[model samples]
Target: MVASQLGADGYDHTLGDFTAAAFTARAREEAGWLERLSTLEAATPDDAIDRDLVLSQLRGWVALASWPDWRRDPAVYLSAVFTSLFNPFQQRLKPEPELVAAAVSRLAEVPGVLAACRANLDPDLAAPLLVRRGLDQARTGRRFLTRTVPSMVRDPALSARLAEAAEPAARAFDELVAFLEGFACGGDWRMGERLYSTLLRERELLGYGAAELHEKGGAAWASLDERMREVARRAGGTADWRAVMESLMDDHPPTLEAMRAEYEAETRRVREFVRSRDLVTFPEGEKCLVLPSAEYTRPVAAVAHYLAPPPLTSSRTGVFFVPFTPDDFTEEEVRQRLRTNSRAQMPSIAAHETYPGHHWHLSHMAGNPRTVRKVFRTPYFSEGWALYVEKLLHEQGYFDTPATELAHLDCRVFRAARIVVDTALHCDDMSIEQAETFMATKASLTPGTARAEVSRYCAWPTQAPSYLTGALEIDRIRQAYQGSLKAFHDRIAGAGGLPLGLAERAVSRPGEGTPAG
Candidate 1:
């Protein structure tokens, strides 16, 4: 519906497939669907437990039409939207001529979508923190269209046509920039506690309020710090974590190529560990590999990202994109990225992004032939599972070395800090600069990367807390399961990629539906 109505250059990143007309008739269509859902619910109210999440997800789509969040710097939303190319976002699709043509149609529609944004968006709400970056994204989109997308087209005429379309798209970007000028202060995008609570209760069915999550975040941060000091004691004598952390940075692979090589080798090492430990069941014949972030994805995906197999599509393999191209980056920039790619960071990150982490979870989810499980995706369950796997691996001794151990603990600290930053930013207590400083100071992020992360948090107000929040919910379910570790993991896998609340419901009532908290 987002693809059909507002196009890909808008708020929600998950919904685009093929862009269509800017002004769509989907609003009334959604209303009809909502009416049907109401009728179905009234007739069989007992089905609420089973259909609760599906209904909520559908309602979210409906609510997205009127979402006030988009009013605040629609261009920033476009930044997220326009950042990835259409083909690779549809990377799993076979490159049949017709399919390519369809993708090209969508790619060519970038200008029309920007025009729609210019026509409809409220510039007063544009995020000050994001307008420059957002317009940068528009500028990049023109490059992508003229250079990237056209290069992919097989037919000469179509390629020429795509290149020709870039000019209007570039002009639309100017229009968007002009529209964005109305907001002298663009960072005013705040999801206050009231609406934040509403989204938690209704859209996510998450039980905790923002304040409570903030408290949990603070506690988690403190606990992880204590654990880090303990590990630091074991590693050396002192708990001066900065010294130890800096030492670990010096132990990484020299160049980005070497870094990628090490990561790929570590991928195998990680897969072996999961197999040897029997921590979780590894899927058969499913492939995952480390690759550079695509040109368009680099602006937003500064660290790493996992691209799941396209659902209900012919694509089965998943791509794990890590930002590690040293050529385009300077020596100092590369060194800072290497600090993130330190000996401590690599294997721990591998455990989270691959093996029993995102790649592992997604491969298993895709192999499952359940329609409902394949659909209705949520970030809480997905990120939570990855973060939980990080801790799970640590507890199982997957991270056995002192530096790896410290890195694992540090990852937790970062997740915990996100809860604080995400909550405080939305509640109006924390500014973006403050959040960046806090994250960089507490989580060991460089200033630049921290700023990028905080910008994303501003763009996506309530999303940052999901990593720890989802993990906490999963841990609760684990304690309640009374089963072996493998069994507990199997239960989570069976629940599929659902919200934690629904996943809990699934565990509580097995064979009912996929659930998340």
Candidate 2:
């Protein structure tokens, strides 16, 4: 619930409540989770599996509970709130009556949530970038509520309510902008060592500090670079993997329609491969679709993206958002977008977003009887599990050609670079421009791609690194367990989406209810 209010993803919040009072109200509710965490941490459970699961989830709640304080700066809080507010309206979901009611209820609070934005935010503490992004999102959100939402509801009364709310929402955004202009933003966005360590312990249920993560991220970058050289040699190219990567971009599907078809086809192959190898169970009736990116979201989703179903909301299906390059884009922009999303890159991205990855992870997580388990997953578990599947597919001979195989490795390298830069950016170890330049040079990301990715890392701290940190952790657990690869994956799934520490305990122990299928 707190995650939803803060605009963090992965929580299936049924209620559409986002009023200013809701933040205070949710903070009060955190006392229970914090008390529970205290109790569980004090007494060791007789059942080892139960002990870890209880403590891990309780810790996640506590971390989420602290976000309001962590983001007291008006600009930061507004960005997340607006982003969260825009989610339901932006994506497609099942048109159930309850969901419709939820939407209506959320609409009622839009004005209040914005009002809270006015009262609680201290403008002077905000970062300039956050202020800028918040304004961009605010305009986008205003447009959404004013122009886009009325058509979706189809309720005369509700549509009227939305119309009434739009003005205050617009006014609130203007108020924020005016307030921010009064003072210079000097707030530190860095998590630093102490706070970063505390969050790592609470949110991810891990004990490692920023320094350890730095070391891990550094090693990953080195390992990936070494492998990229090997692939370059195999491709009969110079050691300049960047040149090879550039060459591959020219081989992309010629049109957006063709790109969509390619994704649809590749996703089919991914699912089939998962089933053929019995990598994981594929429940019937669950479907995955590939479609064009919505205009509002194109700036964020550079290539393709997958909207995983809400675990709590059963009506939704996974939809992959492929880039919809607008007609006004110069010919070069279209070419570059297609090139980055080339044939070699499609399979790995498909595997990461869909089968045995996000969609699959969410499906099983939604079924957990415990509400906390479903709602409180960390990005480490989610992203790590996805990247873990990439390596798993590679080991299983999933990629077709040497070119595609190299593409898989390049994806790994990109994630490793993310780990390195995310830590530096968050720790204030490097400036934003330095982070952008480093990624471009180290990982071969285009200058434009680096900027977009760095901007994203700024918005979401601790997430980009999760790809490498998470995948490496899952692989470590897999090696420890003496079982088949499918069995290892099944155990992790059966345990629900948990931090790797808890997942290892669940997977390693066989007799518990959360055993591998």
Candidate 3:
């Protein structure tokens, strides 16, 4: 579905083959492309950078073939199912009938996909936590197919067609859930130090390895911890940052509706703030919609998530999904969810996920003429920019109040913790239990949230660290920049979500635009 939307023609009507042979063939094909790219000569500076970006991505694809995540991770198939099906509904790039037809076609393919996954996944190689997480997602997938999907289409015939396709799809998910429930996961989740190091150096094009990244995270955590302590002292005349952070949550909106309204308002307010300050340029025809998380995404949704517009489409509208407190939640659970998304923290989240963060940065990325820049974004650039801008806003006094400053610091501290936890988990330095404990204690996340965070790290190695690693690298670039802050921001944003190494090169040169398509 993503490929279909992204101009990879002929994939809209059916799910791609996910068999072992199919994956082996795809890997070989990517390797061939890598070889072809190596033979090309760049005619300009931008072309050189674009070539390097494409090379790095292809290297990642070729390298990952040896690891074969499909054989070890059930979540990979779950992610495929959700992303392929859900994106069409959210992006809405096609007409209603077309979108519904695509969903129905994909839904019809779910059984085969799951059967292939079952055959490919080695019970001895799947980690218990990963399997459990997959089980949870499969249950949620079942609910999404049966309940939410039918209600999305307006036309009765299309809706009925979707519903018909959904029934067997939900059953497929049920079989997956049952399969996972009965299994004993014997594999370790760790990618090991070598593969983790390779991903950092080769895939991300970073200067350092996993160990260095972990060390950097530790240093950053210490710095942010002190900042949080100082801000807590100023916020309520207490050096107890944790206590102050807890206090801010009590000031949240009374209801999720009001909470979402606050996020919408903050998004608008932050956009205006950026405009007034002449911050990074916004792309043409860009807008962001603040709305509730889709039913399918609610299982794995963060407090705030930014869904970018499909780059192949003309629309530059981004959706900021703030999940509602679920109706099934106990009162305390509802309050906990609301408090985690506190009033004081919404502005920082708005800045991180919307204006001058994901929405603004990604809008520029979507507008890039080069398809490589538009399609192959590293989290190191995207997540990094979002995180980097949060600090930029704080330094510029966007978090004017002591409460908001404390809240922002708390988030920074959490990202810093992520650097540590992510490295530890992938490098075999921490167990899943220990990582969850570290998050709950060190980052002050609730138990449930902490488990969710660790589970994500286990499933997707090196991703959690991208938030801080990218931000810190960008900060290094900014420290040496000679231009005005706004100019620096524009230069970086104009680089279009390249690897940070490429971004630094782009920022250093004068008058460089996006690489020509």
Candidate 4:
């Protein structure tokens, strides 16, 4: 089946076959490491040691795959694979403290691994595995600091170990930077198409193959543009949609500190509102903390994101990371942004990243009994859920203020525009310039922001469309269920939360009629 998909060109065959072979080789190489950790756990007979063993196994899988280019900027390829293969297990073990602590310790070693990745790193020999390591490090570091550290403080020894781990782990970040610089210097464009294709398949876990995704992405792009035009009309914008968007940026800019504080306050306020409104039930013994984004990741991520809660056993709490990129903007400009990304839009983002979005979804999935499914997450499902939440919040009147509504619409337009740009750049024969123009004009992105986004789509294909495609599918399912149940609120609350795989199943299920209104 994999061969058939590769076709006559054999690029897919070579890449896919080599990757599979590599996966086998990596598993074998890590066996001894795993065994050693298991031995350590059995011999030491302490919760912390045992937990460390488990984390070692996870990190070992990540470290063994670390390659130079893969380590530097791995959002596209490596992230997809790790999320698919490891997230499920990570989720399952999230509730356990010993395991969470062990995971944190393992993650703390990432910076060291990056430091170890040097300039002489071979792309042919190193590219395939490098990212896996960096991702593992980043993932582990994020999991430990964001999820495990806060809760596990109850254990003095464990707390001390975690505190000690941060410095070395942070030092590892320099290695990461060194490895990335090497990658930028030596990496070729030849692997771009192959890497992009592999990422799309792995992340979506769809049977349609790479070519199909590209084709669908192209088609969706056109469809979404038409939709956005209608939205623009509704907003009474005719003086070039891009101009209208830029105006918004200018109209509402805020100071960096102010922006950060506003976002922080808004997130808390939204969570409180959700709880008070009986929108959803948040579990006990769990908390949320918002921090500044790390240097390495701040380049591409949005202003903020939700780091999933640590496993139940770990002392970690979930984190909402918001980078303080003050250097990137002036004080006045930053202040304008504070008002721009105000209470209205902030709540929806919070909803998407926390509460009923990624954090909540992942937390639940991690706790589910299906261990295999827990480990294997589909980006389509996960990303789709967050995108769906954005619209859901808007629909549920979370964006009650006009400014907030505009903010929500702004995001929606941005997403709608993504479908177009993501598809055109990859499959529709659009140039980088064309893609950039489309984003700037249709999505209302600034020149700088639009250019960055275009680079991202070019580097990683089919990801942008996932927001729109996934949201559409989720909304469709919700509508279908509402039709059958007739009571919208009751139906949503009663249906329980849908896991990624199950959501796909429900969407793909034959003879599934649209929800009856």
How many backbone clashes does every candidate have?
17, 0, 0, 44
Question: Largest TM-score belongs to which candidate?
Answer: 3
Which regions in candidate 4 have their CA more than 4 angstroms from the true location? Answer: 1-24, 27-112, 119-241, 251-253, 272-279, 312-316, 326-344, 427-431, 458-460, 482-501, 504-517
In candidate 2, which residue pairs clash?
none
Which stretches in model 2 have alpha-carbon errors above 4 Å? 1-25, 28-32, 41-54, 57-104, 150-184, 255-258, 301-303, 323-334, 511-516
lDDT comparing candidate 1 with the true structure: 0.69
Tens digits of per-residue lDDT, candidate 3, 402-515, equal 999889888888998998999988886688899999998777566767776788888888998998889989999999999888778877876788789999988888734652
lDDT of each: 0.69, 0.68, 0.83, 0.49
Lowest summed-lDDT stretch of 10 residues in model 2?
40-49
The local lDDT score (0 to 100) that residue 86 gets in candidate 2 is 45
| Tens digits of lDDT, candidate 2, 1-517 | 3454323444433334445566667666766765755555423221444555566655654665544533444444454444444455545453434334555555555555556655665444456675555555454555555656555566677666656655665565566556555545665556566656676776677669777888887888788888887787776466777777777767889988899899889989999999999988664467777887754565554656666665555533677778766445677777777777888888998899888788777665555555546555667888899999999999999986777888888888888888778888887579999999988887656676777788778766787888888898988888888988777777677566677777776676563444335
Per-residue lDDT, model 1, residue 404, is 87
Question: Candidate 2 lDDT (Cα, whole model)?
Answer: 0.68
TM-score of candidate 4 versus the correct structure, residues matched by position: 0.62
Ranking by lDDT: 3, 1, 2, 4
Q: Which stretches of candidate 3 lie over 4 Å from their true place?
A: 5-9, 325-328, 515-517
- For candidate 1, write residues 420-506 as lDDT tens digits: 999899975787788999998888787767877888887786788988888888988899886688867866765676778778766
